[model samples]
Structures are given as C-alpha cells and as structure tokens.
Target: MSDNQPSPDTILRLINGYWSTGILGAAAAHDLFTHLEAGADSAAQLARRAQISERGAQTLLDGLVSVGLIDLAGGRYRNTAAASQYLVAGRPADLSALARLKLTHMGNLTALPEVVRAGGPVTDAAVEVADNPHWGQVVPAIAAQSVPAAAVAADVLQLERAGEISILDVGGGSGIYSATWLERNPAARATQLDWEPINAIARRLLAERGLADRFTCIDGDFHTTDFGTGTYDIALYSHIAHQEGPEDNIAVFTRLKDALKPGGALLVVDYVVDDDRAGPAFPLLFASEMLLKSKQGGTWRRADYHAWLTKAGFSDVSFHAAPPATLVIAR
Candidate 1:
C-alpha cells in the first residue's frame, strides 16, 4: 500500500480500546488506586491489600503504569498526576465512583447491538440511586463532577444581576448550581427539587458552604412534582433535557414556564446539536450514550429546543454562552 493509503492503526486502536477501560475499571473495583495512595505500592503489598494474587496484582499495576495512569519507580507503584486527581477516592473531584459505576454496569452494554438494531434500548430499566446500593458512589460523584460546571453556570447566568432572584432548580440533583448561584448572589434564594438521595446530598453540600440558609430542598421526581405556579423568578434545567425525549422536554418547559413569575427567565443547559445533526461530535456521541441509558433520551437540536419552548408559551427564547454545552434562556 502507498503511504497515502489509510492504515488500520486507528481501527485497531478502537478495537483494543476496552483493554484500558477494563484495566481502569478493575483498578477502581478493587480500590487499587486508593490503596496505592495509602502506601501499598509493591505488587505483593497491593495484592495482599486488595486480596488478589501477586501475579494478578503485578499485571494490573504494570498495565496501569504503561497507560500513564500510575507510575512505577524502584519497583514500587504510585498514581500519576491525572490518576491522583481523578481516580483516588475521597477527593472532591475524584471520578473513581464513575469507574465503579462502569464496573457495576459491565452487563449494561450487552444489549447495545440489539439496541442499535432496534433504534432503542432493549434492557429493562433499573432502579435509580434511591434503590440501588451500587449507585452510592455514583450519586456523590455526580455532584462532584458538576462543581466546575456549576461555577460556569453562575458566571453565565449573571446571578449577580439577578437581584433577589428566586430560582426553581428542577431536577437539581445535588444542587451544585443552586449553591454556586447563591455564592454569587447572596441576595438570591433557591428551591431545589430532585430525588431523596440527591436532596440529602444537596442539604449537606449547601450546609458546608453556609448556603443552606439560602436554599430549600424538595424531594420528588421532577416529571411528577407540583412546581407551584408563578413561584420562582428563574427556572433552571441543567444537564437534564438530554434525558428526555422532545415531547417530555416540551412538557417540562411548559410546566417550568408556569412555575416562573411573569417576565422571569427559564434556562436550559444541554448538549444541543446543530440543525443539520452532523458533526459537533460530542453532542452526537452523547445522543448515543443517552439512547443507551434511556429508551427515549437523545440530544436535540437548537431549533428543536426553540420550538418546544415557544410551544410551551415561552416568548423570546434565545441562546447564551456556556462552555461544553448549549445554554438557552427564555422569558
């Protein structure tokens, strides 16, 4: 083949990608990174700590080292900077919990081929964090993962100028956005609605930041919950629309529009696709991931959002700047 001809390197790399994912998943499953942080560096030491065979431990550690997830020097292993920041448990930004979730949901991907063929998820929907013990890590990790994004939300929303704003944070999760907004606008208060597990997490997170006094937690599913008509100055739906199909999102926007006082704004942050539905790779891929997770959820286009919001009686729907996702504000 000529040098101009394409090679199979990329294809082979994609095929072998799961090898590293499995390595990291195994590490998280056994709490291997945290154990290393606790000073169990040698394979034998890590093996004893994790209750695995020495050979298994050595192979796992070596694979991690080769991937730059961990470093090995003088026959001892340690976490690399990236691993230390994201794979070690107990840190605020640690993603070990997501890794554990990947391990727990290993079987969740078995239906993917069928799902793709059928154009929808084929597996039975599982219980949420409220009922799943395996999601204990995932619950808090969701909150931790949103911290920086929440900070960005605060800036983009211009909470400082939303004087004495009353925000209804729908499907607020751990209330990271609420807390961030409160930090930016001490004069504002928020009502956070989510499941029991998330509300419980939110209470503690807000309390720790001394913002508890600025927020109230309401426990229930956002789809079924009563939003109290005309009760809020702003309604926020962050990273939530992609989890619902267009019709459900339209209903959600309608309800949120009713919840807001006249002239109040409704903000939606989501992975929105361009009108052509081509490229903008992240949103396109997120659509597949959402499809895998839910029977109906997938990324929608900006025009889709505008039409839904407008159909919901929201006038003047417009886009605003928010990194890593599209932000739409309607009044």
Candidate 2:
C-alpha cells in the first residue's frame, strides 16, 4: 500500500472491535479486575479463585493485557491504573457493570442494516421502552457512566451554594442526578419521574446511599405526566433527549420550562453533535445506535437544540461542554 493511500489497519480494527467488547465483558463478569486489585496476580491464582481452567485464565489475562486493561509484570498480572479505577467492582467510579451490560445489547447491533433501511427499529415501540424488563439492570449501569458529567452539572448549577431547593428529574434513571445534587446541598430534595420498575431501582440505590429521606419517585411517562407549574428549582432531562424525536423533545422542554420556578434552570445532558455533524467522532457514531434503536432519535446538532429550546419558551439558553456529554441549560 502506498503511504498516502488508505490503510487497511483502521478497517481491520473496526471490523474486529467486538473482540475488545467480548474481552472486557468476560473479564468484568468474572470480576477479574477486582480479584487483581485484591492481590490475585498469576493466572494460576485467578483460575483457582474463579474456579476456571488455568489455560482459560491465561488466555483471558493475555487478552486483557493486549487491551491495555491489565499489566503483566514478570510472572504476575495486575490491573492497569485505568482498569483498577474503572473496571474493578466496588470502586467509587467503577464501570465494570456497564461493560457487562454492553454484552447484553451487542447482538442488537446486527439488526442495524435492516433498521437503517426501515428508518428505525422494526417494532412500533422504541427499543428503550421495549426493553423495560432490563431497565432494573440497565439504568444503574448508565448511572455509573453519567457520574462525572452529573457532578459537573451540579457544580455548574452551584447546587452547593443554593438554599433548600426542589428538583424535578425527568426520566431520572437510578436517581444519580438527584443523589449527586442532593449530596451537595443537604437541604435540597428531588422527585424523579420514571417507570415504577426503574423508580424502584432508584429508590433502592438512593436509600443505600442514605439519601432516601431527601429523594422521592413519581412513576409515570414523562410525555403525559403532569409537571406541576412552577414547582421545581431545577429540572433535569439528562441522557433522555437522544432517544426522543424533535417534537417530543420540544414538548418535553416546554413542560420542563413550565415546571421550573422563577429563575429556575433546566439541564439537558447527552451526546450532542456539532451543527455540521461531521466530526466529534463519538457523538457522530452514537447516532447510528440511535438510528438502530429509536423511532426518530439521533445525536442532534447544537443548533437543533437551540432552536428546540427556544421554541419551547426557554428564553435564555446556553451550552456547556461536559466531557462524555454536553450540557444545555435553559431558563
């Protein structure tokens, strides 16, 4: 191949991307990183601890090492710093569950070709609601992924400086936002609106964090639910917009605008593409997932958001870059 010509290496990597997913998923399932962090060093030790064949353990370890998630030092295996922090169970910011959860949906991507041709998932309902049975597991994994961005939102809104505040979390899966913000302001209380099943998960999680008293759940569909007028100091529409159509988003934004008390803020956090939609690789590619899963959803442009929020009666709108996601604030 000529130096200036395209390289097959990129295409090869893209085609074999599932190899990494399977490797990460299997390691997470076995709590391999957690074991490594707990001092299980050699493949033999891992095999004994996990009740697996030593050969299997060594193969998995080598795969993890190649993926930069495990470090192999002289006769021992250990989690890399990144893996130790984010792939070990029980860590504060652990994403091990998220890695495992991705495995459950990997097969769904195979439907993408047909889905794209049909312009959406084949079913009448979007895959989001269509997979309600897994919400109990799915929501919390997503909540873990949202931690950093949620903290940034709480800081940007200065929840710590505020007095007693009332928050409305629309589709607040796992109550992560409520927990994060309420932790910052002891006087703050939050109500999350979601399905009863998902609310149950959020309640259990918030209670486990000793936040039960300050958090509440209103189980219902956000589309038709009543968001009482001027009842909230803050309203969150995080990670939900990318799964909705423009009309639905505008309608929800309008309701959120009406739900906010005077001087209140509404925060929307999601993978947002630039106006041209040509770059910002993650958000651009995330659109494909939306196309395969939702009826009329995709990573939308910043301009689209500005227009939607403006149409929804949000007079003041601004955007903030929160790594892994973007925050659009409207008031």
Alpha-carbon RMSD of each model: 3.8, 2.0
- The clash count of every prediction, one per candidate, is 0, 0
TM-score of each: 0.80, 0.93
Could you say which candidate leads in TM-score?
Answer: 2
Give the alpha carbon lDDT tens digit for every residue of 215-319 in model 2.
Answer: 989988898899999999999999889999999999999998999999999999999988988867889989988887777888999999999999999888899
Worst 10 residues of 2 by lDDT: 123-132
Q: List the global CA lDDT of all models.
A: 0.82, 0.88
User: How does candidate 2 fare on TM-score?
Assistant: 0.93
lDDT of 1: 0.82
* Per-residue lDDT of candidate 1, residues 1-331 (tens digit): 8999999977886677677778888888888999999999899999999999899889889889867898888877899887887778887667776776666666666778888998887766675445566444566666656665666667766889878989999888777788878988999999999888777888898999899888998988898999999999989998889978889999999999999998889989888888999847778877767767777888989899999999999889887654457778899
- Candidate 1 error regions (>4 Å): 26-92, 126-135, 320-323
